[model samples]
Target: MNKQVMCEQCHKKVASAWVTKIEGSEVTKFSLCEDCLKAFSLKISINSQNLPLDSYFNCLNDKEFYPERLSNFKMCPKCQLSFADFMQTGLLGCPNCYQFFGQQLRPLLEEMHGSLEYKGKIPVWAPVTYVLNTELKALKNELFSLISQENYEAAALIRDKINTVKEKLTKA
Candidate 1:
């Protein structure tokens, strides 16, 4: 038998949405019922059409929920593209729009891509030193995390791996 999870806010309804936020070394997690989640999303200023959450939270489609006129909406200085226009068109007016609407677009991008940082594919023809350098950087990060958690055994293994990558880089 599975235990039912109650909403953290209302505690009366079953939780339908889970939210997690990680800042630096700290992490926070909570679950919300449909109603509470909808209210929470609204409070966060989630643009309806900008995110796929609108399909799940149908209340966002209601015009009454956002009564402000288009003129009052935030606009990009470079392209003059309003956030409202982006929501309606589902397109950014210019590359500068990313910087202009970074705060609002961040959540949507994170939801879709799972991370803000881009880890693009490296071509097979890329230099061996370049590949080894990337591997060394990732191993160092993992080593730091393991050390922070006091996992010396795992950190030792990562340290060995980093040494091997460094040797390969030196040879290349």
Candidate 2:
């Protein structure tokens, strides 16, 4: 009897017929079996088409993907399907994602950006060893001074800068 190999993604025994090797790239791409290849191929094809992320959500209709990632709520307005529709999922989909599901997406956005409002730019720096502590602390001190002077607009900008610096200093 031949030992069956399973797909890394679906973990089902691939019947050898579905297995195919892809050597076109330098990446080490191989699952012990083939279902993963099919899943991987579909993902690649969908992305290559430049379609929006929401367009291929139907591919997730299989129901085995994300079991319970979200609070397991937030249904799509168009289809009225809840998070339970997919096994595991995140709150990113549709241009109206913020409009349609702001509450649901808060954790996700906070996960990506410390603040939802795009106040301004911040440069990335290496972590650890009191890196931006001085900068952030100084900004905080300056913000307090500005507020004390009753310069409300300037204080707001300084407060935003302080928040941005603190966001950068701390990981999301």
Candidate 3:
């Protein structure tokens, strides 16, 4: 019996099929398992339609993928999933993994998504009170800061603004 060949993309699983392409005189060949093939996001054009592959197979195209080189190595307590595991699988082991590996994941998330915090659009149909409520929260915080700094004049001004906003909300 022949030994099984590991996938070219992810070294963890055995490769089952071969993907090949020829352009001009150059020929390219790669081996991938079904799971990795499914995870690869490279879309194929067939009959003018695009087919989306699995997104789970990240880092398949990057030959130098290595999370072990990080200065701090953190692991999830619940699933024993290491940061390296997340790098390889592109998935967190469990829900608690977020809390456990948040420090490390923050940078990765920011790099991939452009920001760590979700800045989703507010619904167009949202109530006018929603905007007033947000403004009131900010004004209240400013009032607290002014009072703490002993600026009674500014604090009173903010206090009056807060009262006006409250009255408006109550009326609405």
Candidate 4:
């Protein structure tokens, strides 16, 4: 009888598929269940270039791989779509999904994109909002210092400045 093998990442599920790579006679294998496999995207560096895991697993379209029927209540209030649905479909229901599933998606995003924070340049049109955000941040820091020093009057002034900047940002 063949022994049962569980997925290495989420050990609660049985291993259904695997990925293997061979380099210079050294072999590495990763076993995963269907759910884990759907969210198992990764980026690896080869010859100073980053490569996506999808390129290696592209054969799935030619081979046998089907999503399982799973359901969960963890859903986005704005879209009414569950996290399980996202895992199965690999698509978010709405923009609110980024906030709702942030904790779960951060690792997947970091693995696929190399970082969670955007490193690109800001848009020229958004400079006003950007400046307001920077000003609001500085004012909040000043407010904190004033509060720590027991200067409530100065803290109130900084607080009003922060609120004004926030209002401008929201209106922008």
**What clash pairs does model 4 have?**
none
TM-score winner = 1
lDDT, each prediction: 0.76, 0.56, 0.75, 0.74
Per-residue alpha-carbon lDDT of candidate 1 for residues 1-172, written as tens digits (9 for 90 to 100): 1255789999998776677856669988998877887776432335544454445457644577664552226667666577888888999988998988887888889998788988677766898888888889899999999999999999999999999998888889
lDDT of 3 by residue, 1-172 (tens): 1356679999887676577756669988898878878876666555576556443224433446564454234445466566877788898877898888887888899998788878655555779799789879989999999999999999999999999999999998
lDDT per residue for candidate 4 within 10-100, as digits (tens), equals 9998776676867779998988877887677666565687767665445335435442222144547666677788888999988888888
Off by over 4 Å in 1: 1-72, 122-163, 166-172
What is every candidate's alpha-carbon RMSD to the true fold?
A: 18.8, 18.1, 14.7, 16.2
Residue 79 lDDT, candidate 2, scale 0-100? 40
Question: In model 4, where do residues sit more than 4 Å from their true spots?
Answer: 1-72, 121-172
Model 2: pairs clashing at backbone N, Cα or C within 3 Å = 66-87, 66-88, 67-87, 67-88
Candidate 2 residue runs with Cα over 4 Å from true position:
1-71, 79-91, 126-172
Candidate 4 Cα lDDT to native: 0.74
Reference-based lDDT, residue 116, model 4 = 85
Cα-based TM-score, every candidate: 0.33, 0.26, 0.31, 0.29
Per-residue lDDT of 1-172 in model 2, one digit per residue for the tens?
Answer: 1244455566766533233444566445445443334444332346457554334545554466573453365555544344444325543444544455556657666878876777434445644425467667778788889889998899899888877877776673
User: Clashes in model 3: which pairs?
Assistant: none
